[model samples]
Target: MKRHARITLLLFFGLWIGSPEGWAQTTESGFVPLLNGSSLEGWEGDPTYWRIENGTLVGEVTPTTLLKTNTFLIWQQQQPADFELKGIFRITKDGNSGINYRSERVPEVPYALKGYQADIDGQNKYTGQNYEERGRTTLAYRGQQTRIQPFTQGNVRELVKNNAWTMLTVEKSLGEAEALQSRIKTEDWNEFHLIVKGNRLQHFINGVLMSDVTDLDTVNGKKAGLLGVQVHVGPPMKVEYRNLRLKTL
Candidate 1:
């Protein structure tokens, strides 16, 4: 090949390697696995709802052991800021779960987190949205690029009562919600990725951008806290996670 053609080819491959899909392939280099698969060594949660099965981290809510509130399996290693988390998850059809980051434990509630979550559900309705666990609520829906603004001065109490600590503006559309949902595999294993740096958070599913949020609500936004996975309060279901890894930026 000519020298110019060779240089152009190299540039194309370089760009590809820097893309999100490319990051999926190379992120393992700097990431540390969060789970040991054989035991919950650096984790804490209710033993009744969380365990290890077939070398996978499992959280299940059985019919006889229904939960009154969502429960989480929290990683006790560290609370990472400006980091990347990636893992494989599979949930039963009736299941709902999420990966929480920059989160704090609910003081009065056991095994509860109050921060940002990369939402997941067996139905895929909210598979890639950014939802605050017990704080600002929905910051960005699937296929949305949103900016979260601080609350207005008027009726601050009412806003807080309404679970509206922040305001959100959809800056752009990433894609149609249904189109993005179509990319998710139902009741099967899927790769979930989160890139959180400063006040900007982005979620990806199977290398596809599902939601993006630039949080400007410094008053309510969190820079860092705990890392956890939850099993929501609902019917009997099972959620499994494996290959849990994190790379702090």
Candidate 2:
């Protein structure tokens, strides 16, 4: 009887160790602040567009400074492989921007990056989509859980587009896109979170899961690269980011 009691206690302890509560405690810690909130110290970008204003990272475009191409403000510290990033962002009514991760720089173009982007816009039309900049284009739209398959001639009928470059198969719908968009506050601060591990990428907006993607196209998918925030080529607008934190996994 004592031996059975001991075995039961051991099983209970083992289950507790691997429980959701245990994982939550560990995963919630170890976050390090990425922004100083006072200056752009560990970052690189076009001086004309990126700056720190009143303790917030700001990117602005005016009538005179209309951009011919998108510009990015890159983090110079490290190119994280598996990590979780959390930050708060606000933009004007017509602003368009995104957070780029596991990306590479375009040497010919100043402050340009190409990789996966957590798309953001003032209209909430694409506030939480996974877009591959200068690559496969849209990997997953808002409220989607998608798998990116390698482009092949055999699956041409199932392809999303005309070419092999765009082959995203929707595995399931996470939620209604309009319902998810309602969680975002326009022209106000909204939280954005990203969990990137291996080929799986998940994006959340305002603490709600917005889009998820599993990239199987190893030939075109990126595993590790730089981190950046973009100021897309558009009308006069402003965007601000704060409380940028990262926890490497």
Candidate 3:
């Protein structure tokens, strides 16, 4: 009887320690979905430009016959300091689309008119790179020539894909601008990750280090307002976004 009781006590202690650690590990490592798979519960934007259809967030350009206005699908949940954002996006037409971060809120102006933009283009002319707001040109691709020459006019034409999903990422440290990473393959799914620390930024595409620019000039100080999706007005176009998630550091 004494031996059996001792064995039972030992087993109980072992299970208690082991089971709690396993449960705790799962909880800590679990990923919370930013988009709830049905509607834009935590997002705010113009209805004419952004909407959720079939679990994908769609940003559509109005018809050319309609009036033109700069509209954005802005994240209602704002992040100020360091954070990492990942998303899967696809452009249906050959046009412009971008993920805007560290942006300030202007009453009617375009969201990116204030912050740094991680630009992706479906047109085959510009490189997928970093472009500062209505300010001086920062880091850009070295070997390739942009379609819109002079680089500051903000005409991007590289890494743009039609009917394909493209992974994009941007990391911004306080008072520093992040660097541009490599171009992932289009027509299939890819992964992108970014890390931002004080005055230092790193970009990764498919587990490869693409850009590691540091000591960037301050554009909008340490903290900014919101994250936004861009739908440049011109010819009619549609862009779909999914798996959008953010982690605050």
Worst 10 contiguous positions by lDDT, candidate 3? 19-28
Candidate 3, which segments miss by more than 4 Å at Cα?
A: 1-31, 62-69, 108-113, 124-127, 142-183, 187-190, 219-222
Give the winner by TM-score: 1
Clash pairs of candidate 1?
none
TM-score of each: 0.86, 0.84, 0.63
- The superposed Cα distance between candidate 2 and the true structure at residue 220, in angstroms, equals 0.5
Q: Provide the clashing-pair count of each candidate structure.
A: 0, 0, 6
Error of 2 at 78 (Å): 0.1
Query: In model 2, where do residues sit more than 4 Å from their true spots?
Result: 1-28, 151-165
TM-score of 2: 0.84
lDDT of 2 by residue, 1-249 (tens): 699998886675542232221211112367887778688899999989999976678999999999999999999999999999998888898999999999999889989999999999999898999988876777888999999986544443344464223567899998988889899999888888999999999999988989999998877788999999999998999998877889999
Ranking by lDDT: 1, 2, 3
lDDT of 2 at 52: 93
Model 2 score (lDDT): 0.85
Model 1, runs deviating above 4 Å:
1-27, 152-157, 160-166
